[model samples]
Target: MRVTLKLATSLDGRIATGSGESKWITGEAARVEGHRLRAGHDAVMVGVETVLADDPELTVRLPRSDEIRQPLRVVLDSRLRTPATARLANPGTMILTAAEPRPVGTAEVERVEAPDGRPAPAPALEALARRGCASVLIEGGGQVAASFLGAGLVDRLEWFRAPILLGGDGRPCVAALALAKLADAPKFRRVSAEPVGDDLWERYDAIR
Candidate 1:
């Protein structure tokens, strides 16, 4: 699957404040562009922590159009901790978990082999690919982003940066990759950069 990682953050690459308040990190235009990006992808994904914290709908909210097919919403819940009352626990949503399959509202539950408790990025993407997802958009908290990048599965990156600054105490856009040296870091080549209202939109492709 073609995996694309999307990040909307402050100038310092912080996704949220120290208290985890992440709403409206970018301008309206950037958010609209985000929805557009979702419309282009076959599936949109996030981690369980994001669901527990934000409870986002993960749906395309743009004006109704024939061309817009709401991408499948996916949550990586290794322990099946996703609440049934969560906004994403509905039809068209899928929960990939390592635990036994159980009902989470009307959403589909698929049990995947997660040996290390968390579902590895390659296997998770393989499962999505088997489900007919040619392209997947990972819109996440932090750990999920790091997992994909660390596994060398991310094909493209769509980043939106606001003008505001969140200090070191703020939540980072990506979690620790555990790279021992600078040369081991995942590299990406800049594809494009443009302004989206008060935010800047940057696009990149994996340098592999």
Candidate 2:
């Protein structure tokens, strides 16, 4: 399966304010474009932290189209921290965790053991493929995006940059990487860069 990391950040590379307020990082046009992008993927994924912060529905909230395709919502909560009342606990949602499968609202809880602290993207991507997911859109809050990127699992990156700046005190767009050398960093080749309303949409091909 192909994994695409999508992110919206300020000019200073911050996804949110210092106080965790991330309601609108980009413009309305960018948000609608994001929803349209989600509609093309087989599944949409995020981390437990994102869930706790946003409680996003994870649904493709766009205008009705002739070919409507709603992607499955996938959550990575290795410890099963995702609450039953979470907004993503709908019928089309799937939770991956190390704990035993427990009943959550219409969603399926699958046991995904990660011996290490980080959940292995290989197995998770394999599982997604087994369920007929050819493509996955990862909309995250730093850690999750870093996990996939660090694991060399991301195939593409869609970054939306707004003109506003959040300064150094804001939350970064991505988490820290444990790279020993500068050459060890994940690299990407820019595929396209276009202006999306007041925001800039950049697409990159992940260099494996």
Candidate 3:
């Protein structure tokens, strides 16, 4: 299976301002494209921080429809810190915990389930791939996204560049890497770039 990384950020590469206030950072076109992409995925994954901060449902919906495409939601709560009230605790979801989790309701629980004792995402991802999840979409804050990028597990990328410049202190939308590490950089060939209000929707492929 393939894992695709998706995110929207300010042109200055900030996911959120220093105050942690951000919404609608991308234009309508970017959101629409995101929904369309979601329609094709079997599941979506996010970190515990994202679940607490955003509480996203990760459903695919269009303007004219009341129904939504529900995918198996996976949470990367390495220490099982996710609260009971989080949206991901609802049915049709899987709670992947590295350790025993708190009693967070009766929703089905799936352990990290890796061949090795390691709880790193790559093995969990491979398990998902074996389950016929052709692609996994990762919608998250910087840390989770950075983990995949650093490991070279990302097969594709979709980034929306907002017009605003939050400047330096804003949390960087992407994680950091050493300059020498870039020698193994993933090749991204731009597939599309169109203006979305003051923002720009960009799509890339990991051709290398």
Q: Each model's C-alpha lDDT?
A: 0.94, 0.88, 0.76
Q: Candidate 3 lDDT, tens digit per residue, 113-149?
A: 4433425677768767766677889888787787777
lDDT of 2 at 162: 97
What is the TM-score (0 to 1) of candidate 3? 0.87
* Candidate 1 lowest-lDDT run of ten: 59-68
TM-score of each: 0.97, 0.96, 0.87
The residue-level lDDT of candidate 1 at 126 comes to 83
Name the top lDDT candidate: 1
Question: Which is the better candidate, 1 or 2, if ranked by lDDT?
Answer: 1
- lDDT-wise, the better of 2 and 3 is 2
Rank candidates by TM-score, best first.
Answer: 1, 2, 3
Ranking of models by lDDT: 1, 2, 3
Clashing pairs in 2: none
State, as a TM-score between 0 and 1, how close model 1 is to the true structure: 0.97
lDDT of 1: 0.94
lDDT of 2 by residue, 20-62 (tens): 9998989999999999889989999999899999999978777
